[model samples]
Target: MFDTIRRYTARLRTSERAQPQGTVERRAHNLFEAAAVYVAARVEDDQDRIEEAAAWVSPEALSFGVSELACRAVVALARERDESPGAVARDLLGLPAA
Candidate 1:
């Protein structure tokens, strides 16, 4: 995650330098949006889009967003599987059952 953030930060800086000041009106992509796009991009194996989405928010915010997304996913999977969130998470990661 940190490495992803670092690469995105570099790309963001480069893009910012390339753009002119006060020309384009860009709406800020919140942490949640960034997290969603980042995850979807990863699932689709789109590295560039993942990096671009990661640049939408501060690294700390993006981290929090990603963590929140993971928790939500675990909960949803747990519900679908009729299992506990911890068990679902561990199963997803192939960890030994606790």
Candidate 2:
């Protein structure tokens, strides 16, 4: 996961350097950053930060990023617990075993 984020950051830098000086850049925040901040803000009940992060990307993009983050987190937790991802995810949500 960290490797994937690092590669994405590297790609972002390379793309930025390749762009013409006069071109307008998109939002400064990446989707992953936005998703992380947004999720953290929600967990902390920080509406202002949630709004700020949400503004960094389109709603659909944010949703996709959040979903990806959740999947990665579940997989990590599953590995740590020597359990299945589905079981980990269900446990996180307080759901009963299948």
Candidate 3:
């Protein structure tokens, strides 16, 4: 899983770097995608990929992306485990069940 996340993030970075100067809108979209990739790396516990992804976007943008990913992940895990989203999130983070 970690290897996969690393490879995916590397590809994203490479593609972004290869692109010529893009419009503000396109850059913003890329940043969001980068953030999502960062979140995936985090979920996979891949520190290297997380750092690589972080370098692709601003700290603020990455934070927002991570928050968005966390919410979505919680919902999905909740459904899979037949538990509340809050519970799933807490459990995933090793927190006491809420």
Q: What are the candidates' C-alpha RMSDs?
A: 11.9, 10.5, 14.5
Model 2 residue pairs with clashes: none
Off by over 4 Å in 3: 1-29, 43-48
Which window of 10 residues has the lowest lDDT sum in candidate 3?
21-30
Q: Identify the superior model by TM-score, candidate 1 or candidate 3.
A: 1
lDDT of 1 at 86: 95
TM-score of each model, paired residue for residue: 0.74, 0.72, 0.56
Per-residue lDDT, model 1, residue 45, is 99
Per-residue lDDT over 1-98 for candidate 2, one digit per residue giving the tens place of the 0 to 100 score: 99999999999999878988788876589899999999999999999999999999999999999999999999999999999999998899999999
- In the range 4-67, model 1's lDDT, one tens digit per residue, is 9999999999987797767886889999999999999999999999899989999999899999
- Taking all chains together, the TM-score of candidate 1 against the true structure is 0.74
- Which of the two candidates, 1 or 2, achieves a greater TM-score against the reference? 1
Per-residue error at 50 for model 3, in Å?
Answer: 2.9
Clashes counted in candidate 1 amount to: 0
The global C-alpha lDDT for each of the candidates, from Candidate 1 onward, is 0.94, 0.95, 0.81
- Indicate the TM-score of model 3: 0.56
